[model samples]
Target: MDHDHDFEWRPGETLEVDGEAARTEASWFREVLGRYASGVTVVTTMTGTASGESPIGMTCQSFTSVSLDPPLVAFLPTRQSRAYAAIRRSGTFCVNLLAADQADVSDRMAGPSDDKFAGLAWHPAPGTGAPILDGVVGYVDCTVEAIHEAGDHVIVVGRVVDLATGEDTKPLVYHRGDYTTTG
Candidate 1:
């Protein structure tokens, strides 16, 4: 086994390290990473609510397609996220790709609110019972396939079970800590 302790690991940048502390290096690392643009998505799941079942969602930009043969996808959520916990319990989730006009929805879901789904319209995904937002560009229903611990986040690999595509629309993009629409 080769242990590479001298390598400096950053989220989206590579740097050679002499003696810089991780905390001090993280700010610059994060700023550099922000230069990379990424599409915004809301990862949602149905959870037990007082009346019946309600949707819990959180905005995430770390989603990606992992495999095509086995139909795998993945997203990273912070360990402290409540929505991630609900998704884990349900064993299923839906990835809602936001349209450029859906920034309000993304903001609402990303915040720490008891009723994130309040005033939002959504329906259950046919296969997984996950909540799929109405105005998203598309949605992917998935079952939890695997989970790996990564620092303060968990990488959740999901097996895509069902999906739906909506009309062509500008995708919501995040770059440099702000939201924008792609050309």
Candidate 2:
């Protein structure tokens, strides 16, 4: 309820509600958070069709490891995310960590295209039916554990069921609206 300590208000830009500053512009929040560099990932899930199953995926940067002992991971997806909606129905998903060379994949997945898996080579994850993209730095296959509503995004907690890593691949990083590779 009290979010006064959650944000740093700009000078002369505070909104007071009963002597507490209200929420600020979403763009301002995004701009401030974009300064930090983050690794990129393609979160994928499978959706059943009239004939068979199909892959649905989206480029996501709001992903992180939550625990090692329990093998937990988390990603934030916007409420309007169609891929996430399919993932929720599937009850399983995979997070494919992108290599530096996979920026094209990231761009394609991040777009509004209906078929993000077009022209991409992928296989089903062993533990989950979610698509595991080729040429990624690593993959984390998981089952949906919990979901928490946070503003316009939903924080999805996943219990990792399987994982794998690729060799000699540089991670793709996003910083200040641009993509870069680590040294």
Candidate 3:
């Protein structure tokens, strides 16, 4: 017979909140969180092209290094993306941090269509045999450690197998859905 609002659970359902509350809270949280600034990246993987020639495949943002001892990196791909599926099935990828001047490359990889790696300067990274961006601030080549679902995205954890560092490049940042560059 307790009518307390904090009943430890919703009075009559599995969800703690109703639909209206979910939308309201989600929108509020999204707006608050979108204010955070984050670096941009063009994560890539090697694949066979239409001519059966090898090429690097790419997608923008969503890259991070999670651990150093085991040398693990993490990146997320919105689960709905075709490239996400491809990267998952391919079982390997490289994280390429974008230089401030490489915003165009980042945007190009963000798309779902067209060839992404064409003319992208790169060389074979050992272990994964993936293409690491030639001008990136740094690159981490890894094999996936784990894949889990988070919100609307798939959390990908990669165990670093090899790494390379490029010449000093100012990091490209993204905030409020806009690119920011400052030297």
Q: Name the best candidate (by TM-score).
A: 1
Q: Total clashes, candidate 3? A: 0
Among all windows of ten consecutive residues in candidate 3, which has the lowest summed lDDT?
Answer: 6-15
User: Candidate 1 regions off by >4 Å?
Assistant: 1-23, 49-51
lDDT per residue (tens digit) for residues 107-136 in model 1: 888776888888898888999888989888
- Candidate 2 achieves a global lDDT of 0.83
Which one wins by TM-score: 1 or 2?
1
Runs with alpha carbons beyond 4 Å of true place in candidate 2:
1-24
Residue lDDT tens for model 2, 33-136: 87988999999999988978889998889899999989999998877688889989999999999999998998898777878888899999999979999999
In order, how many clashes per candidate?
0, 0, 0
Arranged by lDDT, best first: 1, 2, 3
Model 1 C-alpha lDDT versus the unseen true structure: 0.84
Clashing pairs in 2: none
What TM-score does each of the candidates earn? 0.86, 0.85, 0.77
For residues 56-133, what per-residue lDDT tens digits would candidate 3 score against the true structure?
455555677688888888887666665666678778887887888877777677654466777777887787777777
